[model samples]
Target: MLDHAVQSLREHGVRMTPQRQAILEYLVTEHSHPTADDIYKALSGRFPNMSVATVYNNLRVFKEIGLVQEMNYGDASSRFDFVTSRHYHIICDTCGKVVDFNYPVLDEIEAVASQLTGFKVDRHRLEVYGTCPTCQAEQTHTH
Candidate 1:
């Protein structure tokens, strides 16, 4: 995955710096859908001079180059996902965790919408929100 990400970045003429490499490595390995601050906190120890702004900047570049996806969960910061394939995310409302799930594409829905509105349908995203099992268990214990 790291090699593929590096190749994709190079294909887009993006430089592969140490910081960027570290950021990409973290994103590819960590499926937590971490925010920019989370990334900075995780990598700052290794790259002592790296800043949060650097993480944000690299993330922006990655998004622009189609190397990563930026997800806004109505939180303070947007989270980053490394997987570029078409998939859906299930977010835990109580714990604020994001998990990925793959489902068959809903091409019929897009076709219907395009036919009804006469507008070209590009793509769509679906996010399911609920309490994760751990959160549910915690709630049960507390109650």
Candidate 2:
């Protein structure tokens, strides 16, 4: 499926440079939301010839093509997500881990916003912040 995605990206004039391909492949298999620095670290070993700027440039292309999503949760570092579907996120305040949450209520929330605000709504992102289960467990143990 990802190969098809990459081919589609190339067809749409994405350059398809080797570095860009590597980035896309990495994103498809990664479950964790990774920052640019994280990506640079992982690729540095194999792609010593590739520059961090190249990763940023390719990420921009992926975002432009809607193949990747960039997220900023009031953090200095921006994280990148590969899952592009309409979904919400739960960000762990302790670990800074991000997980996808598919809630049907989000549609209702969008409807309410449109009804009350009288604004044309195309899309929305809902980010919930809290300690993850593992973090909560650790806190309990410590206390």
Candidate 3:
């Protein structure tokens, strides 16, 4: 996965610095949709000189080059997802965990909307939110 990410970055004309490599490595293996602060906290100890701003900048670059997706879940901070494929997310309201699930694209809805509005339709986003199993289990135990 790291090699694939490196190849993709090279193909997109992005410089492969050590910091960038570390960031890519983290993203490729992570599914939690971490915020920039989460990334910085995890990496700053290793890099020593790295800053939160650097993480944010690299994430912006990755997003612009289609290497990552920025997700806003009504939180104060936006999370980043490395998976670029067409997939939906299920967010845990209690624990704030983000999980990915694949479903067939709903092209029929787009077609119907376009027909109704007489405008071209683009893409769409879907996110389902609820308490995760762990949270539910915890609630049961507490009660």
By how many angstroms RMSD does model 2 differ from the true structure? 1.6
User: What is the per-residue lDDT of model 1 for residues 69-120, given as tens digits with 9 covering 90 to 100?
Assistant: 9999784479999976788999998889999998875547788889999999
Task: Give every collision pair in model 1.
Answer: none
> In order, how many clashes per candidate?
0, 0, 0
TM-score of candidate 2 relative to the true fold: 0.90
Every model: Cα RMSD to truth: 1.3, 1.6, 1.7
Question: Each prediction's Cα lDDT score?
Answer: 0.91, 0.85, 0.87
Model 2 / residue 2 / CA error / Å: 1.1
For model 1, the local distance difference test gives: 0.91
Runs of candidate 3 exceeding 4 Å displacement: 105-108
Query: TM-score for all predictions?
Result: 0.94, 0.90, 0.90
Best by TM-score: 1
The candidate, 1 or 3, that scores higher on lDDT is 1
Runs in model 2 with CA error above 4 Å? none
